[model samples]
Target: MAFSGGFGVTAAQGATNPNNDFQVANPPNDGISSLSWSPTANFLVSTSWDCEVYCYDVQANGQAVPKASIKHDKPALCSAWMHDGSAVFSGGCDNMVKKWDLATNTPTQIAAHDLPIRHLAWIPEVGLLVTGSWDKTLKYWDARQPTPTLQVQLPERCYALSCTHPLLVVGCAERHLQIFNLSNPQTPYRSIQSPLKYQTRCVATFPDKSGYLIGSIEGRVAVNHVEDSLASKNFTFKCHREQADIYAVNSISFHPRHGTFVTTGSDGVFNFWDKDSKQRLKQMQKCNAPIPCGAFNRDGSIFAYAVSYDWSKGGQDPMASAQGGNNIFLHATEETEVKPRPPANRVGGRR
Candidate 1:
């Protein structure tokens, strides 16, 4: 192998502290709102409150940069991809959902919703898609049809949800985590429930050889037996916070190996924690605005995040000066007053 270069410091005699830190590229002064990673590739997708969605290629050491992009008519909130990576799905404040075909580089006509879409997930073993929205409803759809296959009503603000075998887990802005049984596709029965506020960042379901887990926005990570419906209220741990006040937890991704997990927080950090012991392992400091979502790469060696700009003061308020730009930074580059590296390799060295 060729000696590429060296910027990282050494930890011990042979241990290397590789430069795997984050740098804001395309830093939208508006700040990022949400992020997602491709299920089978080295690509990342992030959304900005400025009405833009960005796709990036993850570099060898895990840095990210813009690869392709789509400037939308509305700010996208939730994004996901099909199991085979043929298409991308997004739901947003515009009260619409869309399917972007990677092969055609075109989006199908927007699928309208009754309210702002807060979260979306592709059901693992089926061809259905589910979205939770401000409309206080969860709509399930068939990619082949323009209309939803089914819709479930909610009593309050619905923010996020997850799916496992025969179950659909949902959360609301009013702090409700409701579990639904999907054994009968025509009728989803509520199986469990949990409490949370607008502070819950995200929710997820994980599967392994014979076990599964569920994580919440309160920085709680829980694991249980695969078919154990007994894990309804078993979470009991918090993420590592250095100097940030974790107001909201937006997303959670369980590692593919070693059972590690990561979360994005309103406190502005991507926290990595061990699986069973629930101990803090590392931190990827980037979250600024309350992050709306996050996830890890398929292999778990890499990760991605999506953030919505902070509008807590109000929607009409002026954007922050330092973060007013509408770009999503992927990895740190030497493109600064300190010692910016002139633009060098692009396209992950592929093209």
Candidate 2:
């Protein structure tokens, strides 16, 4: 990766130790709401409650250099990158979706919502930008058009959404799950209730595109298969919990190459899990604050995570301000960290 300016590293950036995982140089001032890595490169864009969307160029050596930043009228809640990485789309409490042209550093309003936009995903297969909002609607934008090409009224306010080619899974308020077969995007393919009891926090599709994972505020994750015949394969597991204390599973991200995944939580910790083996692969030490969001790079070689307030207590917690402010960390992933365990090593030896 090529960078034009010199980057400076602060003392806090060295706190995590550079050998394994280290802090990025400059992070947002307030809580991070979402993270998205470019589909084509090491470029990363993060949306924050500070009303800004920050971009960074992650170098080959794990050094992240600030590339640019754009502001919203209110807290920027979510962001998605264009398929070619030429631009970024972000939405926030301002109820407006803006596409930022990375080349010119200009932003254009492309869509709007009646309530806060909670999630954004770029569908390369259908060439549409999907936006989920608390207004109980899902809007598909063409980027070149002034209005949404299609608007589908959801059963409830959307909480989390994930798309993998033909499949799009949406988690909404009241534990509703709407599965969309993008091949027929006009209506719901299947509607069901979430397996977990509590509110949904995050959702991510499997790299193989056969199933998806759902994380809940109750510190549980459910592995779900799309086909009705595979219902026996669906299961839920517990994580990010200690004795007498349970933390919300804030984010779930799958490794692009291995199909194994990671879950970050409000417990200030992250763990790797293999759904096939039904085993916990690895767990990292707890950070100073909650891990609100995380994402794997294009090749799954680098894992980036945010250590900040997640609003789990319903309001701003003083913990983030006391713990050196919001920070982002990059972990150099190893084969053992994310790769699925051998069949012989798995429990029951069924795989």
Candidate 3:
């Protein structure tokens, strides 16, 4: 491995690398935009800018043949699985949220996003789905209703959102981060003011902390300890490759059962860190394309990735180039050495 900053252990996986240790494909063209896994089932769900939902069976040698495909005419932005994995919930540029039954190729269209759908999160206990959109609003759906179950107005276009236990969080393009107490579901009992240094791209929290992590557009990250309305940013780090432009944060996921977290940046660098210490651990930096999303399940057993290149790289085709760079990572109990085989580029290289 090439050494640049510090002595870091080397791990490489990419467009043609599935990290499956089981199967690899020159991942197909989709410009994968979102991804998720059934909390209680052996399946994975993902969405692309093409308005299609791709599901994969979670087994060794598992082939990600499309489980159900929704061609909505407009682009789909993000998705999440139902509590029981029976259905898939998705939101998109169509300004609406739709639920698809995995058992059958059925779509149940619900509330409209009013603007481009940026992200969606599912709260199982309440049987509700939460969405953030460019329309400058955050809406919640009962899934049981034909319309948004509830709505909250933000100051700017909503960029990302997440719901963990007692709190429902939202990020704004203006960099404001809001926290709501979902125990009441209807109204956010509290809200926090974000620090002035960066424009936040996303926010995350583990199962064990009152604090949260924020990914910013300014190539930095911060940790905030918020309990009720009182909050403080305990630490912040310069977290991206040095460049003349802002480093956009793509996606973040907590280590299911450990004190760790991972993030994908616009610079095509994936970072692993000590969730509690705020220390950067390992980084996968080979991708020339920007990765938009990544996820890890509760046990360190399964993982998923979706890559999209920097639009300014070359072509203007929104769906071309890195659109097909999808990858799956699994930590097998048995040994797995992921070597970068540059043979005829079997996993499928750039078209």
Candidate 4:
């Protein structure tokens, strides 16, 4: 790959470019662990197993120019942007969480966990950074402080986490899911088992905040409601599988505006779904590499995904890396692809 200037890289198209989609310039040398879009801008941040966090400024013409990057002592597992898009917070196997100021490109350690942090979310309304770790605990921190404001124990290692204002959901190993009403952030609002039979892989809150979605290693997703009265509405559906071949559902991202969402999987496919109608909205052609993570931009105009080795088979596959699987792709969202279908045109209920 050719370098642009300073720390940035110029855009380069991929060999199997799909229509309306373009590959981002330079990507992490190893597997991508997570992707996050700034809440107030088109800027995107990605954390990877390569121990680096990268920021890119995606221009309107579909070109992603690298803006900045920072390195951790170990693989960075997850990243989340500050509310104003001025900085980013990341955590990983290093057992440390660091805040990177975009202006100066400086990083400062803010918190630490007993074990590797698996996921993190920034709760803007609460002005706290919440991190879930393999230590079987969830800790909340105010970046300005030296220690966590609060820490809650989990039943098992945290595998996935997602937050939306008053709601925070954590999916742990052993199919344990704990929901927190952030208004009462000290304790869980509810603790329950995930509907999916296998290990929980990822979780995402609905844009409306009425409920959340859980994806599992068995290629199934569960739609659940926060209220017991709406419990009947909860259901599970299958995806990221063909016949007997099943792959883990790696990531789920919701459209900031449309309330629709997408799920990317280890099978190298991503699908858009509308929970209101229990129907599939769109399914992109499968990639040659696993899509470990993805996210939609602030206004839901752009969808960015990482096409790379996910290490789903336990250890690294050198062959996949040798074929240059580390890359990012940007898909310009079309109205019909993400917009909600009319009630009349909707059909089906769970898979």
Q: What is the C-alpha lDDT profile of model 2 across 133-204, one tens digit per residue?
A: 999999999999999999999999999999998899999999999999998888999999998899999999
Per-residue C-alpha lDDT of model 1 across residues 27-114, encoded as one tens digit per residue = 4434566667677786777766667666776666544566666666777777788888877888788888878887777777446678
- Model 1 poorest ten-residue lDDT run: 9-18
Point out the higher-scoring one by lDDT: 1 or 3.
3
Ranking by lDDT: 2, 4, 3, 1
lDDT of 3: 0.64
TM-score of the candidate numbered 1? 0.74
| Error in Å for residue 259 of model 3 | 3.0
lDDT scores in order: 0.57, 0.87, 0.64, 0.87
* Candidate 2 segments exceeding 4 Å error: 1-20, 316-318, 343-351
Question: Tens digits of per-residue lDDT for model 3 on 187-291?
Answer: 655555566366777788655647677777766666666664534436566665555665767777877665567777777567776644435555554455676
TM-scores, all candidates, are 0.74, 0.93, 0.80, 0.93
- Model 3 regions more than 4 Å off: 1-28, 228-233, 242-246, 310-351
Q: Residue by residue across 1-351, what tens digits does model 4's lDDT show?
A: 221112222344343443336678788988899999988878989999999999998876667889989999999999999999888999999999999998888999999999999999888898999999999999999999999999999999999999998989999999999999998988899999998899999999877778999999999899999989989988898889877899999999999888989999988888888888678888888777788999988888778899888888877575464445588988777777788875533322345
